[model samples]
Target: MSEQTTYEFHVAAQGDVLEQYITARGRNTFIMGPIGSGKTYGSAMRVFDQMCEQAPNSFGVRKSRFVAVRNTYPDLKGTTIKDWCDLYHNEDCQLGKFNQDFPPTHYLDFDLEDGTRVKAELVFLALDRPDAVRKLRGLQVTGFWLNEVKELSKAIVDMCDGRHGRYPSAAEGGPSWHGMIGDTNAPDDDHWYYELAEESHPEGWLFLRQPGGVIEVTVGKGEHAVTKWIANPNAENLANLPDGYYINQVQGKADDWIKINLANQYGTVATGQPIYKGQWNDVLHINNNKLLPIKSHGDLLIGFDFGRTPAAIIGHLTPLGKLRVLREYVSENMGVRSFMDFLVPELKREFPAYSKADMQAFCDPSGWGKSGNDENSPIEIINMEYGITAYATTSNKPENRWEAVRFFLTKKIDNQCAFEMSADCKTLRKGFNGGYQLRRIQVAGDARYTSVADKNKYSHPHDALQYLAQGAQGEVDYERTEQLRQTSEQTAAADSLTGY
Candidate 1:
């Protein structure tokens, strides 16, 4: 077939985000939206468009290969694969039948009206399979579509990204364009997607998010108080769905579910019970303006949570006793010494105005425990090496730590939140928003959660915040107490020397 050959093929991508997503030429492109918002359909159409646009090979044939991925075999069959078939298995566009293999594959080769041949391959794989990585390693493809990417990990995405552009080798005229496309409902704030899209935002990666299907509105007053989910006027793909799809789906569903699946808000699925259930109002406790130290208010307090994943929270206690958390340092698999190396420079740069004397540091009392490798405790390392005197928090009790933070969370001065954190403190904010939580006891019929918080990425940063709160709130002034003890001892010695 000739390069001039043309066959009619068209797929209309609805909504602004989906349209942008389809047209995006970034190396990695992702679209996230509420359920039934046509994310899958748009991704499928984009794949088809990409396949058709491939540069014709030596024999006037467009060649391409694409892999579609989901989290599990069932999800691949039930959702990702089914969506592909629904879009492609039609008279207007003819692609070969999808084969039932260990990893499903569809081989397409058809001639166009003007004698151009289109050849493409579609492979579908599930991550849950034991040989998933082995299969991924063996693939060379034009591109990939990460179906329901929220269920997959960064590693899976990276692996898939590496596989693309390898299928249409240099001999086969290479791919006209190569990249990855992904679609998903909203994921939690702590998710890698959120970190990459919202924080890192590296070059050659694009993320487009459709407006939520519904918006929460307050409907009733105090005694008759109620929150309702109403259809959003700008919601996409409504024309293709049943009447009131967004509204109907929210019926009898929890607010969190509706927020995530319909509203397209980033939130956790709540496998665990939230530590600060009702106390943390994201709106109230989180300041939109980047919080900075109020120099005249009080000294900057640094809180530390030490161990494999060390974390630090830098904040200030205002004259009104409001805790204004300004910055956070969270690291994984780093020793206290290494963490200090990074933190000291950051502290100097971030809070240049504050001198060492103007900053007080507190840490988990357990930081005093020596590990096998290091005879020096974390506290000792910070003090002796970093030259920053750090005090161990009075009580390492979980309840005390929790209550110290709760005291600020529940406290209000003239209706203003006593505990306010900068919007940039995403990790800690996510933790307060439910990332750091207590695991739900999995007893049938009875709902219960453990009293102690579950340890995870969020826990370390939160633990640091607890120490800051505990120290700042006057639970015990370890520094002052020590000074007083020394003063008392000195006074007694003076009296003995005077023979009194």
Candidate 2:
């Protein structure tokens, strides 16, 4: 009789959730946890298990295909691809070079027990841009694994589902197991993943969340101190980490960073002093009372900021003497013509009640220079081509325009803000919440602060808004203007009758 040989290896569960995660059955499975929680390792192990589960055909080959995806090419190469290679270090697998052919493919040809052959082609993809969805088209995959899914949009997740469970060909008896698996750290509450996991809880979807680690630090006399890292009860993979790993990581970090990276909480963190500190509050500024519909009669006041990254804001003067910003449009790497193309359609769609004749535009005074393409100023393009007469702000000084916006942000009437932006205006909301902030300059051999807000992503939208605020600050209220006009007309009629 021939001697038999058995090869045995152990796969230890890193945490309470890892074992359950490896065997969980679902159309879509998500493993979410804090840093160093082994979410990626658990997800990759599941993918390997599914590849091995492919039943052999008549030719004795277990054929399968999977795609390991990330938000960008650099992340794919640097993170997911490395984690995948590490997962199968002991297996008799050969990893092929990343082929640059159309629909790029990476291969991992290996063998299983009982002389069963496995050919698992692993394709790596990056879905970074809006147009990146095109790459997922026409792909037939047994399943897919998305790493750091917080960086990806929900559209990419939906597209992956549509492409999965169709690989290895039906003629080859189809896949034994096929579905999508993903791993992520805590993302913002507004992200779609939060909705899927926290709100929707769709059928055939399994979400496993690991608890965050806690660190407490105490200082003693003479600069001595004691610190403790308490692993959350639900945290996993503690055996793999060094002593005090979680505690050391959070030392001297900001509260927001600690909350996100260590506590695994979802909240906003400001890198510096928020420009609209004490002026804007999410609960107060974004209430329904502040976001009411616009009245139909007043001119649609528009503020324009001109540059390679052009932006515009459309607002109207409320009867209560406040500025209600209704719509905002922003784009980068576009000229005035393209910007107008985007803005004009949006304006017509959002404010169908208002016509071009009822629109009044205000632009940055600096745009009056003949430095643009075709030697025509932005003001010239707006008036001549678009047929909407535009005027530049009276002052181009940054502080003057900033003060104009600050007046609206700070000076309230009857305990209400004088200015409010629609909640749908995300870019502008970011601006009010520290996106438009002063650049912190570190002085040599001293600790002093500078109050100069640097121009950045938030600058253009805020600049656009400043034009509206500064221009409208000196504007006559439509209701007041109409009342004065009527009073003058009535007096003129009485005078005419007396003269006759």
Candidate 3:
């Protein structure tokens, strides 16, 4: 190429949201949207914009380095890098050759209209590779772009956070901007992204959500109601997609998939039949406002389901017999003792008004089983090691436990349902909505689910909830059934005695 050959790069943000995302200057910024909402494009351009914004050094050259990261190598290469190349590599200008080594790298050297040269290095890395974390620990980039941030963990993001702002030493006019930017399609409610965007809202962090490509509307009425997805009139990046992109994408997809991927909603894709299918109503059972423990309402009933994944549900049984589930605790691969350690402090912190005396704890009868490492069972440990006394429920029968929960779910006390859950119980809400489910048995003729609910992240918490329900007046259903049995035997004996 001749020295006289000059290049100019031009790109525009697709929509208002994308424009806002590109211009956001938060120390940590992220954008979430549907499939073709220009999230990746906007984030990619933001890096270049930041590089050019940096002040020129003694040689009239603006310099910066940015890393583009994805959770897997295939995604980093196939999607993330492909999108970057499609934008920057064209006929009129060439950014630079992207080296395809272990960790791909690209160097961009261009001259701006102000006569200042922009020299930026873009590195692409994947977290799945064994050496990736080690390599990330050593990077000294000005900023980072987390492509599909939901696929990565908070640990990786935290690590990336510490590695930035160390590049372009102060002596050479340090970087004008140093931080991180990311983009992703809608993630599930259980994802860390949801916690950060919907709950935490940490300082110096900005999260923007673009309009969905589609909107869900319920058709029909009452028992006949069905959900239908229609194209959203205000979807972003429509000019760059096919005529019926959003509508066509939902052709044979599940409602959950359409809601999450196209509608840009936070929800899980249901695989099996929901455990509480028709019985559980999210709109009716889940309170619009967060529920807090009522001082007058009987003692807080805390239920536990112990195992590798220990779970607990805290709620109250009102004098009116209304069951209000306030909070839930779900952990992965944690022991009972450790889980209690994490939980007790949280309970105290969140519910300072309620003391140990105001709380009643119950556990699954299976908690009587001893752990391999310890002589005491989970229930024994809770009662003996900890000052809190946790009693084992009368029966761990699935049918009895299920009936106990169902009793409240279907029961109505003074017009409103006896069961209600706090808005903060996201996991439990998802479970009732369909995360806790019965595995569908593959058969050609008709659809059929297993006799029992499938074990999953949701099931553990649901188990705890069932225990809570049973302990808090739900056991009356079991006792009622037992009384019916005794009545039946007495009637038979009386009939025989009268058969003279």
TM-score of each: 0.61, 0.50, 0.60
What alpha-carbon RMSD in Å does predicted model 2 have with respect to the real structure?
A: 12.3
| lDDT scores in order | 0.82, 0.72, 0.82
Candidate 1 residue spans exceeding 4 A from truth: 2-6, 71-74, 95-104, 110-117, 133-139, 153-155, 187-204, 217-228, 266-326, 329-345, 351-424, 436-500
lDDT of 3: 0.82
Pairs with steric clashes in candidate 2 = none
In candidate 2, which residue ranges exceed 4 Å CA deviation? Answer: 1-9, 89-105, 215-229, 268-500
Candidate 3 residue 475 C-alpha distance from true site, Å: 23
How large is the C-alpha RMSD of every model relative to the true structure?
8.0, 12.3, 10.3
lDDT of 2 by residue, 1-500 (tens): 12223233366679877778878867788877778878888888888777777888778878889988888887887878777767654344333345646445666555555777667777888987657768877778899898998898887888787788898889999988888889888776557886676546678888776667653323342224333345455557877888666667777876556555765654343355445544554434543222434655478889999999999988888776788887778899999989998888777877787788878788887776877247667877786678675777777777788777767766678888887777666677766755677665666874344566667877898899889988788632234324434665687799999994
Ten residues in sequence with the least summed lDDT for candidate 3: 476-485
lDDT of 3 by residue, 350-402 (tens): 88998876777788877877878788788767765665657777888877787
RMSD of 1: 8.0
- Ordered by TM-score, highest first, the candidates read 1, 3, 2
Off by over 4 Å in 3: 1-10, 72-74, 95-103, 153-155, 187-203, 267-270, 274-423, 436-444, 448-500
lDDT of 1 by residue, 378-404 (tens): 877776567676788889888889889
